[model samples]
Target: MVTAIVLAAGNSLRMGTQNKLLLPFAGTTVIAAVVEQIVKAGLQELIVVTGNEPDLVHQALIHLPVKLVHNAGYGTGMTGSIQTGIQSAKGNGYMICLGDMVLITAQQYESLNTTFEKAYHRDKTCICLPRFNGVKGNPVIFSSAYKNAILQHDDPEGCKAIIQANNPHIVWVEMDDDAVLRDMDYPEDYAALINL
Candidate 1:
């Protein structure tokens, strides 16, 4: 059982919106659609980390049967949410995803999931990272071996520090899907998705 944590507790500084996660993509809000996609993937149970506007986010996910945890320290940075989610994650690994990732598909998830299974069966550390067109994306899979490494993180610099420190342990999974690289944060992004 892999724990899937949806990090949705960030202010839309660049996008200049009150609730970027709730912004519409196609017909549905990005968070709603992303959560639905993750749910259908059958990776594991879903946990949404909320901050800023908890009430609205909670309402947005009212229909989904997912656990919601508010990060009081979300303003400090994304590290708090990441740490909070990591601490709450069950099973031997976690598929940490960002709520703003609207373009991610079940096929991309299956690719990473397959990588994790292969690495686990061979007794290898499986830090599954999705790479699309040479660019890496989120919903990174961290193996149990890195539990101590991730749980020990404290600098509050997000995953950059951990990924850099453990470059040797990283398991890069090549993905052809461009959606992995698409994250909506601005009106133009929303427009582009609509145009698609």
Candidate 2:
């Protein structure tokens, strides 16, 4: 079983005072859409790490069947929220999802989850990363074998360093769309995706 960890603790400073995750998308908020896809994928468990506007984030996702945890150290960096999620996650594999990447479809999540299970059977330390048109993308999956590595990760910028160090264990899953490459950080990104 793999647990989906949605990282939604960012301050969204790049969006100029707007909580990008709270923005409307596809008849629901951005974070909700992202979580809905994961839920639809039927993963074993789902944990959402909330920060910034915790109450609002909670309100937006309260209707969904997901475990929401607050990251008190979120202002420090993403690693802390990741640690929070990792602490609560109880699955053999953990899928690190970005809450603002609403474009990723349920089918894509299912595909990645399927690939992670198959690859895990072959190698316990297997990591599943999605790529589109040769470019790597978000929502990578790591087996619990790397739980300590991720928990001990000191970088505040995210898990790129860990991913690089374990390059040999990575299983690059080719994706059919660039949705994996698109994450809404700026207003223009939201504008473009919303218009699509």
Candidate 3:
């Protein structure tokens, strides 16, 4: 089974005082819309890691059947939340999702999972990543074999180091759109999302 881990613990430092995940998108909040697509994709389990404003995030996702985990160290960086979510995950594989990337469709999420499952069955240590054209994108999936590596990851930049070290294990899945590459980081980014 694959557990979807939605990382919603950003401080929105670039957005200046606003939490991008909580901002309005698609008639619902940003994080909720992102999670809703994953829920629709029918992943085995879903875990959302909250920080900044945990209560508000929870309320945004109150109707979804997802497990919410509070990452006390979220202020540090994304790696801490990644570790926190991995610690609570109960699956053979994990899909690390970003809450701010609201444009990723349910079909995209399923495509990643389908590729991960097929590759994981052949190699239990495989990692699945989405690529648009030749560019890599967010919401990567990793087999449980690398759980310890992810937990022990020291880079505040997140899991790039692990991906670099395990090049041979990566299964690059091509995506149909650039949605995986876009995330709401600033006011302009939000504007672009709304305009689309």
Candidate 2, residue 20: the lDDT equals 94
- For each candidate, what is the lDDT? 0.80, 0.94, 0.94
Per-residue lDDT of 73 in model 1? 89
What's every prediction's RMSD, in angstroms?
1.6, 0.7, 0.6
Give one digit per residue, the lDDT tens place, for model 3 in 136-155.
Answer: 99889999999999999998
lDDT of 1 by residue, 49-100 (tens): 9997888888888998788988998988877887788777775677888888
Clashes of 3: 0
Tens digits of lDDT, candidate 2, 158-181: 889988988999999999999999
Off by over 4 Å in 2: none
Spell out the clash pairs found in candidate 2.
Answer: none
**Which residue runs does candidate 3 get wrong by more than 4 Å?**
none
TM-score of 3: 0.99
TM-score between model 2 and native: 0.98
Cα lDDT, model 3, residue 155: 87
